[model samples]
Target: MPQTPHIAFIGAGNMAQAIIKGMLAAGYPPNKICASGRTQAKLDQLTADTGIHTSIDNLSLCDQADVIVLGVKPHMMGDLVKSIAPAIDPSKHLIVSVAAGILAGSIDSWLGQTTPIVRCMPNTPSLVGKGAAGLFATTGVSSAQKHTASTIMQSVGLALWVETEAHIDAVTAVSGSGPAYYFLMMEAMIAGAEELGLSNDVAQQLVLQTAVGAAQMAQESQQTPAQLRLAVTSPKGTTEQAIDTFNKGDFSQLCSQAMAAAHHRSKELANLYKA
Candidate 1:
């Protein structure tokens, strides 16, 4: 196995901390993982929790890191990259950004023309070590660098690469914003159950377990989702009635529209940080 690179996170917020914890759990050495934050309090918390090095000096962290993860906010990314550009070694350092709406071109401009940049969109589920992330790499990145970046993201969950940066927006709409969509659906299901006389606790348990089991089955089954759905639907059964009501409400179209809106917003946000 290839030796794991030293991973440094520029932001020590929840997402950064989640990845750091995941890396440690995945057997990356504690000494090889470090994070920098703007606040002493957050840095202290990270150190106390992970036993990894933490600091308020971003530039210093970059100097020692083999793979640097930019976990800062979209608005702050430009300035942060610029500030640490001097410490970045294009030949040795790999840059991975988890900030939304920040494109690889803009990041390369802020850092260096030859900087190996990988743009990633990882969702909130990463906190629980079950995230789904989409990555897009710039021309400057080598295959080794790509693998390193993938390993870091996979430490928390699934990491997939997109052929073009444009597809990252579609990913942002799907897995990036997907958890909230499921949460909303579960909320409605639980509320409907309560209205239909199920106790609150019972409804919550049923809906939560159903979601878990459904996802597990979908993953384990050889059949596609459509095939699985057809298998579940019997002739004029109770499931069929619920499906009919959803179809009448144009559920599929509604979901498509929602994802399209998210894709559009992602583009708009990226434009805001154009170089």
Candidate 2:
């Protein structure tokens, strides 16, 4: 890997902490990172914890970092971008955003066209170093800048690029919010296990390991998920009985409907910014 350059985070929240931790763990020294937030106390805490420089002003962070990451909430993005626009210089800096529902074009428009911006959708699991992010960049973005952003994002987990903006919404619906859906399923499954007289510890460990192992197996296999399901279901086994119920319940249809709703809402959020 190339030497990790100085990067500044415009927010010192959980998501930013996750990125900072992952980068630090990957051998990026504390001096290469800077964190800025509304509160001095929060910035102070982050500085103490990570040894990175801390600031309350976005402009100050912008002046010092090679990459300036917008880490604030979606709705605050427009104003934040405008505020930091004066500090960005195309020759020396790259801007990357982690605000969901905010587009790269919008950031460029707010910052003046010379600055390159990248919009990314990353999830909460990044806090624990298990994150998946969807990234999209405009033509103005140089290859080196995209790779720099990718380096920061991939520190947590996987990243994929999409040609158009719409794919980021689909990513928000899937990997970004998908973890919550899995957690919900795990909760119910564990409850069902405990009801069958398994101890809480055993139930939790079994379900947790099952989810991890299943994900690993899926990644390593050439088979489709449907094919994997069939491989697990025997002629007269317990798995077959569960599959019969899931099929009867139209699991695929339900999943499609739920994901569609999430995608629609992401678009609505972007429109809200326009409004």
Candidate 3:
């Protein structure tokens, strides 16, 4: 087997930690992984838990890593990239940014080098190894580097590449903010069930299970979600009545509008963080 590349995470936050845990679970060597963060205690905890190297010295981490994951906040990305720029060898190092709204070009500019950069939009579910992420790579990235980036993200969940960077915003609208959308629906369902006389605990449990089952069915079945919904909705039945009520309230349109709003906001954030 090929040796795993040295991967370094620049920020040891929840997302970074999730990716690290996922990689470890997937059998990536602990000795090949390292992380750095602002808080010594957190880095100490990560080191203790994962057996990966941890430190507050970001530059040293970059020097030793073949793939550098920029896990800092968007506002901190510029300075962080600049600080480690001197340590990066563009020919050998691949930069993977999980920071939202930070563009690949901006990172390159900050580094003052023609770097191979992969910008990834990974969701919170990544923490649980069920994430969906959209990745966009700059022209400088080699095919091999792209594969490496995809493999790293896939350790946590589903990873797909977008044809253009703009589509990443659409991805953000879909998967990045999508978990909250589902959570909101779950909340509404639980409330409705309680109003219909189900106890809170029962309602919560049933709603969560229903969500899990629905998602699993959608994943495993050959039928599309629409087809599955129609299959479950018999003529003049309870499911049909519920579907009718949702349609009456223009649920589909509302969902579209909400996603569009999220997409627009994603662009706004990108612009806000641009150098």
Candidate 4:
């Protein structure tokens, strides 16, 4: 394993906090981490939660840490990168951006062409150490640097490395926005259950636990999801009824449509950033 470089997050918001907690869970000492944002109250809470240093000065944070994570919003990304560019030493420091719409090229353009940049799209489940991250490294980033980025991301959940940055939009569609898709499914299930005369809590318990158990089964068993779905659906039973309804409603098309919409939006955001 490569040396775990000192890590610093430029924003101490919810996403940054999730990463911080995940890092700690992965055995990074509080002393090895630092976080900075404009809000001192948030920073103070971060310092209290983890022994990592906290600051409102991005430049100072940049100067000290070996791996800098840009956890700010996309709109503020350009300014943050520009301010920390001078503090960044390309040879020793690696920049990992978690801002959704900012690209690796943009980070390099704002800092310097040679800046080792990695773009990561992380989801909300990170707070619970179950996020799926989409990661891609720019041309100059080393193999060691790429693994380091993977390690940082996988500390939360799963991290996938795409062959090209273009595929990240697809990633943004699938796993990046996947949690919300599941949430919406749960909402619909709950509502349907309520309509069927089950108490809200009981209905949610059935659907939610089924979701969890199904995921766990897929993870633990050698069987595929299709096999598992078949295993659950009995001949002309309730499960089959539900499956028939879903098929008739073209649930697969709905999924495709939703993913396409998200992908299109991601492209638009990237275009906006370039503008």
Residues 127-241 of candidate 3 have per-residue lDDT tens digits of 9999999999999888888888998999999999999999999999999999999999999999999999999999999999999999999999999999999999999999999
Model 2 Cα shift for residue 59 (angstroms): 1.0
- Candidate 1, after superposition: displacement of residue 56 in Å? 0.4
Candidate 2 error regions (>4 Å): 1-4
Clashing pairs for model 3 are none
* Prediction RMSDs, each to the true structure: 1.4, 1.9, 1.2, 1.5
Model 2 scores a TM of 0.94
123, model 4: CA deviation in Å? 0.9
lDDT string for model 1 (144-174, tens) is: 8898888889999999999999999999999
Please tell me which model should have the higher TM-score, number 3 or number 4. Answer: 3
TM-score of 1: 0.97
Candidates 2 and 4 compared: the better one by TM-score is 4
| Candidate 2 lDDT by residue in tens digits, 1-275 | 12566899998889989999899898888888998999898888888888889988789888888888889988888888888888888878888889988877677788775677788999988988989999998777788888988989998988889889889999999999999999999999999999999999999999999999999888999998778988999999999999889889998899999999999999998877752
Error of 3 at 37 (Å): 0.5
Which candidate order results from sorting by TM-score in descending order?
A: 3, 1, 4, 2
Q: Which has the greatest TM-score?
A: 3
Q: Global CA lDDT of candidate 3, please? A: 0.94
- Residue 214 of model 1, lDDT score: 94
